[model samples]
Target: MADELIFYTNPMSRGRIARWMLEETGVPYKTEIMTFGGTMKSPEYLAVNPMGKVPAVRHGKTVVTECAAICAYLADAFPEADLAPTPDERGSYYRWMFFTAGPLEAAATNKALGFETPPDKARMAGYGRFADVMNTLEHAVSTTPYVAGDRFTAADVYVGSHIGWGLGFGTIEKRQAFVDYLGRVTDRPAHKRAVAIDDEAMKIAQ
Candidate 1:
């Protein structure tokens, strides 16, 4: 018998990113929709994720948390999806993925909260200046058809989500490169399906 895959998430959270990746994998899994300040903080769900956060995955005995890690793990776990990068693609794959998860996420959140790192304190920040992070990210998506390379790998799933969310919420600048890159990566059946699922879930929650 094969191990069961379980996904814990809320429709209104980063779980949407994992939902897209799960759809891309074309695998059978179970979904648990957790509500904020409710089931999410329950002892049962807390056991799965100490932080009581949405977007955690449990594949049999193994548990994976964090959106980037979930994307990479799903790609590797279901090799048939071909979302994981090849040997040569590993460099860019890991590079952009981690960059989005760390610097990009930190910088965007801080900016949205109206907090900026001072010049002298920039050295202490992992993302440095907000402008620098934006410039580097624009160059990344514009230089290649996808973040990892010519192909759309798990890296795109992670990177694209951040860019898309940022653009949508006005957190990230509306650069031409960012808009164009988002259009390229999201024009897929899996993305469509994922959006539809989450949208319906949102309606229900409302």
Candidate 2:
């Protein structure tokens, strides 16, 4: 028998990113929809993720949290999907994945909350300046067809989700490079299916 795969998520959260990666893997898994301040904080879910966050995955006895980690794990777990990067692609794959997960996420959240790092204190911040992050991101996406170069890998799933969400929510700048890169990565059946599932889940939650 195979190990069971379970996905915990909320439609209105970053769980959508993990959902897309799961769909891309074409694996059979169970979805557990959690609501904010409710099931998410329950002891049951808390045991699975001490942070009580959605988008955690339990494969057999192994539990993985964080969207970036989940994407990487799934790609490696189901290599038949070919989402993991090749040897030469590892540099860019891990680079952009961590970049988006750390710097991009922090900068965008701070900007949306109308908080900016002081020029003098920018040196203390991991993301430095939001504008610098945006410019770097633009260069990253514009320089290659995909973040890992020439192919769509798990890195794309993680990085592209942030760009897509940022663009939709006005957290990311409206650069032509960003718009083009987003279009290129998301024009796939897996992405479409993920969106549809989450959209329906949102309606149910409402």
Cand. 1 Cα-lDDT: 0.94
Instruction: Give per-residue lDDT, candidate 1, residue 37.
Output: 90
Candidate 2: which stretches are off by over 4 Å? none
Find the number of clashing residue pairs for candidate 2: 0
Per-residue lDDT tens digits for candidate 1, residues 2-31, read 789999988999999999999999999999
Runs of candidate 1 with Cα error greater than 4 angstroms are none
Q: How far off is residue 93 in model 2, in Å?
A: 0.1
Worst 10 residues of 2 by lDDT: 84-93
TM-score, candidate 2, is 0.98
TM-scores, all models, native as reference: 0.98, 0.98
Task: Give one digit per residue, the lDDT tens place, for model 2 in 1-206.
Answer: 88999999999999999999999999999999998999999999999999988889999999999999999999999999999887776999999999999999999999999999999999999999999999999988988899988889999999999999899999999999999999999999999999999999998772
Compute the lDDT of residue 94 as modeled in candidate 2.
94
Q: In model 1, which residue pairs have backbone atoms overlapping below 3 Å?
A: none
